[model samples]
Target: MTAPPAFPAPHPSPLDLGGRTALVTGAAGGIGRACALRLADAGAKVRAVDRDAGGLEALAEEAHGLAGAVEPHVLDLTDLDAAELAAVGTDVLVNNAGLQLVRPIEEFPPDAFHTVLTVMLEAPFRLIRGALPHMYGQGWGRIVNVSSVHGLRASAYKSAYVAAKHGLEGLSKTAALEGAPHGVTSNCVNPAYVRTPLVERQIADQARTHGIPEERVLSEVLLQDSAVKRLIEPEEVAEAVAYLCGPQASFVTGTSLVLDGGWTAH
Candidate 1:
């Protein structure tokens, strides 16, 4: 409801983050893991947060030789207070953690819907709140929300995911307006279907819901609307996040960078 006192300065290099601190949620796997690695590659001190301690450990191991370092912080985003606390002092924040459940509105479980919204929408809000002060003080920050095509367009049986992403898109734009005066840019990267463990796991759920074979879910359901006809890679989505964090995108804010492989074009 209230805004922070803000303006950030400038960095010359597009991908250099020599002394920056970045907090990436859902960093244990999927888009989160890729983003952590990408930010660290740019010399950021990355605080990788996720409930998966094992995955975070493996991520740390994989980031051993990067230009920056990955500090694994195991925390479930459902703990709103802790999620906010964990975001303190971050220069950049990537809100990418999410879960999906496929079912008709009549059949959808309320608990699952609540969990999805809490993690995807509520946690991001807390993280942003925690990070704003430091960003405002320093006069420069980037907030990248890894949204989805569903943020702009809806599909059947993905009510929770759609609602959460749409809410995130609005939140991102509002942050952009409020934080712009303080040298912070907020934006959403709307990727279509992505190749990740989460998406892979959803294949079966989707198949069951659609009464289709698991093998056909990808071609018939997920990619049906995408002109690209393929699932986006996690690294590709991370690159978009990196760009938004870079010098080139300093002027780019309050926007949804749609990378839906022409899905929206149609």
Candidate 2:
């Protein structure tokens, strides 16, 4: 066989988020905060939304020195009316707000299950539906859903989380199909356990559930599936979110970009 030349690597597009407005839910926390910062750094006016007013304010303060401005909003995604969310005038919508509940399916509390579903799945759907009119009118928009590797695979004692993430993926796919003709894109970044307060809380729960030490739960349970054998960094996921929101990803939609560090490779 004849030798073939190697393909050149593609370069990233220059930052050009100027004149754009992005609304990021859960912007007060780990991955969400990173995403907000990245978007602002790329010159997009960022509307940082979270239930925690203090954290949102902190984020806004941090972003004030960046290329773009941050507007903090203490909005509870679960309780917000559709019209209210639409009024934010978002060009890119990141449905990043989520909660984790760990319990065996048999022992899972009904209220807890419903709450998780409401926040993770239902809230994103409603936000997208509400934001569509604005995006459609502009004829350009991006919707990035921060999902989890659990959306692709299941684990013990995570019935509600898995179900909600799986449902979110389905919803994103359907939205992509519908938004295609409108010059809008919908996709997801499904990451494995990131080293965040959320995952820290899950560590304690996992330790309690398995009757194992927290260290063991982290090393053997949470990171067991990944070939990297380490928790993913929040900034790594944030970078992926930014790429999806950028101009280069115009044709990418209805896809789940897994940041699982080879967890799903097996």
> When superposed on Cα atoms, how far off is each prediction in RMSD?
8.0, 6.8
Give residue 110's error in model 2 in angstroms. Answer: 0.7
Candidate 2 clashing pairs, residues 3+ apart or interchain: none
Q: Scored by CA lDDT, what does every candidate get?
A: 0.92, 0.84
Q: Give residue 206's lDDT in candidate 1 (0 to 100).
A: 91
The stretch of ten residues in a row with the least summed lDDT in candidate 1 is 1-10
- How badly does each model clash, as a count of residue pairs? 4, 0
lDDT of 2 by residue, 130-208 (tens): 7888889989989999999999999999998999999999999999999999999999999998877798778778888
lDDT of 2: 0.84
The alpha-carbon lDDT assigned to residue 157 of candidate 1 equals 95
Model 1 lDDT tens row, 190-223 = 9998878898788888989999888888888888
